[model samples]
Target: MWNYNFYIYITTNPTKTVLYVGVTNDLSRRIQEHTENKGNKNSFAGKYYCHNLIYYEHFNDINYAIEREKEIKKWSRKKKNLLIESFNPDWRFLNNEINQE
Candidate 1:
């Protein structure tokens, strides 16, 4: 079965200090690009070294994904922490997890 398009991602550094929110249909490719830093230096994810995949949610509809991305973008740091904590309580670096899978 094909995976559905999705958004609602939270990426961070190995230190878990920098965080980035984005929407992308191709999760694996997007994460790879971020980790490789293959984009403009001015970009938040590139500049902040937020390539670790800490959290993500899949959505079949692009509109819903976009809406959720915007909603997360507008949130405060505290709110974002809470959201991440829901899935990753220890704030672990998820890059290795993905790679091992």
Candidate 2:
């Protein structure tokens, strides 16, 4: 049987003042699209330059990934920061890390 991979991810601006939560099957490609979308006023990620990957969670099911994304979206900034700090205390951009794997 074939396995499917999905992801719930968070991205932030360079100054880390803005956050965007989303779900995707292709994290790298999606991040790339976000990068390309930067400066486009119509997109929240683009408008805020929220292409710097900061946090992510993988799921085998798309529904689970979407659900988790929604949950994160509803979280307070402090809660989101705690979640990010749990695995990434420094809030380092994780694009390179995910691409290398």
Q: What is candidate 1's lDDT per residue for 1-101, written digit by digit as tens? A: 66577767899876778789988887777888898993458888887788888888889988899999999999999999999999899887676666554
Specify the highest-lDDT model's number: 2
Across residues 1-101, which tens digit of lDDT does each residue of candidate 2 receive? 66999999999999999999999999999999999999999999999999999999999988888888888889999999999999789999999888887
TM-scores across all candidates? Answer: 0.85, 0.96
Candidate number achieving the greatest TM-score relative to the actual structure:
2
In candidate 1, clashing pairs total: 0
| Candidate 1, superposed: residue stretches over 4 Å from native | 1-3, 38-40, 99-101
